[model samples]
Target: MPNAANESSEGTGFQPGDGVVEEASELQEASSADRTPEEEFLAQMLAASGATNLKEAGLYDPAEVAAEEERIEEEMSPEERQAKAEHDALAAAFSMIRERSNEGKLTTPGTWAAAGIVPDHLIPVDFSDLAFDEIIAAQAASAAAKKVAEEAAQAVVADADADAVSADSSVEDVAASDSKADEAADENAPSVDEGDSLDSEIETPEWKLDDIKVLEGKQTYLYSSDYMTDTYAHWAFLAEEGDDALTLVDNAREESRLYPRPMLAASLSSKPYYWNAEQIEQAWQAVQESGSYPDINTCEASNGERYFYSTDYLSDAQAKALAEWYSVERYMNV
Candidate 1:
């Protein structure tokens, strides 16, 4: 008896024989020596998907399905058709964006401690969009880093007690050690514990951070280049990704500019690379002065907290209002 299913699959670029992969592949290829691009694409895809027989696979005819879709569109009202078109466009746009985003990834050194978690390819690094994932990841990373820092500090303290090492740490002299200990304690970073003693052997399995701080308002940069030996990396630059990298700072600034919000200094203080108060102030100045972030502007709240906003995103009055709401008013109620 002749099979109708086999006959139907003849022109669909999929073959139905004994439902064997090897047989199907041969039959499908032989069916069309001069196949169109669409046919080739469909045939290759169907084969890859392990579609042996169209009848069992429940395959639909592309031409018929497309024609039906066209007919449905023709039946739709103008507004309904417009809405469908918009929805499809949005869906396609999202698909393309996600696809493009997967092409590249960001990474960081283990020495970065908790901050290392941000560029681990968990989220996209593009700054054109203000994604909540990035902000959440940053906050989580900061917290994790701070906790690890405290643990590492305590470990050093224990090691020192065990070894009977004096306060005059080999990393520096007695005076310098005391000065650094005071500086670490005085550092207004969000609960960063550098320990009572300034220890340089702050290595752990999770982190091998000798030092991430900038002394004399100039810290060592993560990336060293031949032209410049400056200790500071621009808040907007990602060392691994080159100048093309758009930082969390840039993302925050863009969010502020586009969304009419404020980026708080206290929020950014968690990053060890720019944790120093004087270094942060100087770096922020240099970043703005570089002319890349011309839209970025700084304003101080009544409580003496600093924040940045974009002129492109908000007027001075609007920026001040929001900064106050978050930095002051929000806290007052809490």
Candidate 2:
């Protein structure tokens, strides 16, 4: 058995496993004290370098490690200091230039100064190394473009003035021709007094014409549809009751003729009439049932919606064209 009094004073009251820890701590303290500064530094370096063992300790060269650091107290000469300051200034200027260039602003020193980014002292350095030539060329090109736009605008104005003069001349010529036509018509027309005198002078006719004179006019009458006249009586009877069905068909026919376009049945439910959904559907059904009107045609779109147009007002070709135009222009948009 070990005697309590015989234990070392430094490791008094040691537990059963404390003897190994105490010995290790004492050995480490003794080793640390015996080591010189270089050895201590080398050991610290070894730890910092993450050396697992002494075999990997060649990661540092001890010869390069000086015992003492040497720093000369000689101040920088004016030229050297100025050169260092210029280098720093140039670096700062280039940094600002690159940053502004990335932001799509002009990279000139003047622009930088206006933006309050570059310092006044940093502006006078060597910026010739930057792509100033390219910037200048771009500016010159922009000026040239502006000049060309101005010239083109002037040319357009001149052409408009010439057109105005030509239009004035044409209007004057039309006025002169109209004046001559009016004079001829007035000379040929029977005045009120002359008509009265002729009635008084002749009981019947003094001369008989052998040939009839034909006046030149348009070949076709405007909006003259045989189908409209044929269908008018039926439409008139249906519209006499002021029914929405007749109104729908009447508007479809009239507007289709005037605008030369197909009319969507849905458009009838909006504005000036404001028919409800049921009313519009009822009117549309009535239009389909009325077989007396053969010129009424309906086109069904891809979405299974029907639009109505009247062939009484439009030819077959015109109605087809209008349907196609409405499919792209109105139906697709809606």
Candidate 3:
């Protein structure tokens, strides 16, 4: 006739006799009946810790959480629960595989073992069988493309050298022609008047320049002899000191053994030489008519803008080869 529940609690590993059973029963009842969200959260955290207090369990022990998960799986429906377990296992295996690959490690069975992700019979077949051939084929194609580009670049260099020689020849021819003309002019000059002194000046030849439209804030100047001679050399010489179009093109021929590409009309309006729209057009027209550099040519891009290149430095075929190589190289780098 002692308290029957107290006797039961005493028979268990708990302390006896002091109304412990009733106190524990009441606490359980209160938790089940009206637990607040904060209390429920603490209960879960404590369960994950597998200890009476958080400090005793060292915060949240992963081993305890894993045990709790196993306990949860035991309560779920067999079919749904087994499927979910397999999915989680596969996800973990794949995550290890991806991490190995990201670390620049080879994807082999050894790598999977190192990551502690052994291949399971229930998972799919070997990944190498699925993807290795395709990857190798792609790499081969890339290598071939790079080889082609390198060959094209070599061809461009050869063409540039040949064009430079041709440009030099053209310059020599111009110099010789000028020398001959000077000799002929001296021979044809009328005899000076007997009354004239030896140091008397000769009258300059009369020449005229055509008027050109210019930007409002700028002025254009032309030498009369430039119009009369209508030569690329004369035009280049007559071009203003700061004028870049003619000088830029000429210097490219002399220094680099390369030609400046055709320029956009709008592109010339700004920068080191601010050529007006009309001026650029006129200058290009004069270049075409000068018949000086036979190798000088123009080509258009897909954007419908024309660019100039000197054949005197590189032939058309050589230029095309170099261009294709560069285009491929750029694409690969990208």
Candidate 4:
């Protein structure tokens, strides 16, 4: 009989009864006995590629393989997971450490001094950094200024009071002297003016009564005064004309004497320009029937102009009547 392994190889196609076939059979047997399938495949690839050793063939070293095995085990283990978690926590704390280190560098002058750092010392300190004596001095200055102002104000008040007292004394002296002069005049007047008696003096003619007129269809009253010494004298004429005239006269009496004369003239002239001839006739009839206008003012014969006088100026009511007439005329013409 043949050799047992050789007989087994001949049963398969590896043996064709030649020397080369016999060598192949021996190699196959050696591989089957010594190597796993994976190793055998690696070795076959390495030989075909003409590499001399495992390292040259790009095959992993024993150390690297062992490390790969440990890595796989660690990935699957809870202890490895805990160790990785601890490493991540350490990395996160690195930023806090860096910030604390920077803060320490800023606060501790000795740290910067060791590194030869120089301070600028340029920032200013406020009142909070002032010495106690300096603070007290500032407060004293403020109090002194306030006291000076108060002293000046008190001096002014004292001077004003002294002037007021002097003025009061002068006024009292003047009033006493005037009283004495009035008494002397009263005692001496009747003996010296026998020929020039008060009644024989040329009586100042009062403003003529029948000369005033209000225009037709108008509510205004007009007057003229040729020789009146003051505008205020005219109000006596209004008082005699009853309520309408008296009401206006009272208001005028209260007005200031400084009001312009032309404004007073315009206020008394309230003839509406746009009234038709019929309306004019009706208004004229009303005024003539009432007989109220002539007692209130005088009119001029030269141009049918009327005038009134008062110490106080004509009031807003009288002014508004004239303005309304002018506005109506203007609008109608437009």
Candidate with top lDDT is 2
Give the alpha carbon lDDT tens digit for every residue of 64-119 in model 4.
Answer: 45654444545444544443333333223222223433332111222222333222
| Per-residue lDDT over 27-137 for candidate 2, one digit per residue giving the tens place of the 0 to 100 score | 334566777776566556556766543335443332222211111112344444444444444445445544533332223444434555433344533333232333344
Task: Rank by lDDT, highest first.
Answer: 2, 1, 3, 4
Q: Which structure is stronger by lDDT: 3 or 4?
A: 3
lDDT of 3 by residue, 1-334 (tens): 1222232334334222222334323333456447676556655655675655544434443455565455555655655454454445444544443453333222343344455443343333343232223234444555555565566456555554444444434778757655555554444343465214312332211111121111111222222221223233232333434444454356334422623233334555544246686776676676677766565555544444444556667666655554444434456677
Task: After superposing candidate 4 on the true structure, give the runs of residues whose Cα lies further than 4 Å from its correct spot.
Answer: 1-156, 159-243, 251-297, 310-334
Using TM-score as the measure, name the better of candidate 2 and candidate 4. 2
lDDT of each candidate versus the true structure: 0.48, 0.49, 0.43, 0.37
Q: Give the TM-score of candidate 3.
A: 0.23
RMSD of each: 24.2, 40.1, 38.8, 50.4
Q: Give the TM-score comparing model 4 with the true structure, all chains together.
A: 0.15
TM-score of 1: 0.28
lDDT of 1: 0.48
Q: How far off is residue 2 in model 3, in Å?
A: 99
| Candidate 1 error regions (>4 Å) | 1-249, 257-259, 271-274
Q: Residue pairs in steric clash, candidate 4?
A: 217-283, 223-298, 223-307, 224-298, 224-307, 231-309, 231-310, 231-311, 232-310, 232-311
Q: What is the lDDT of residue 100 in candidate 4?
A: 31
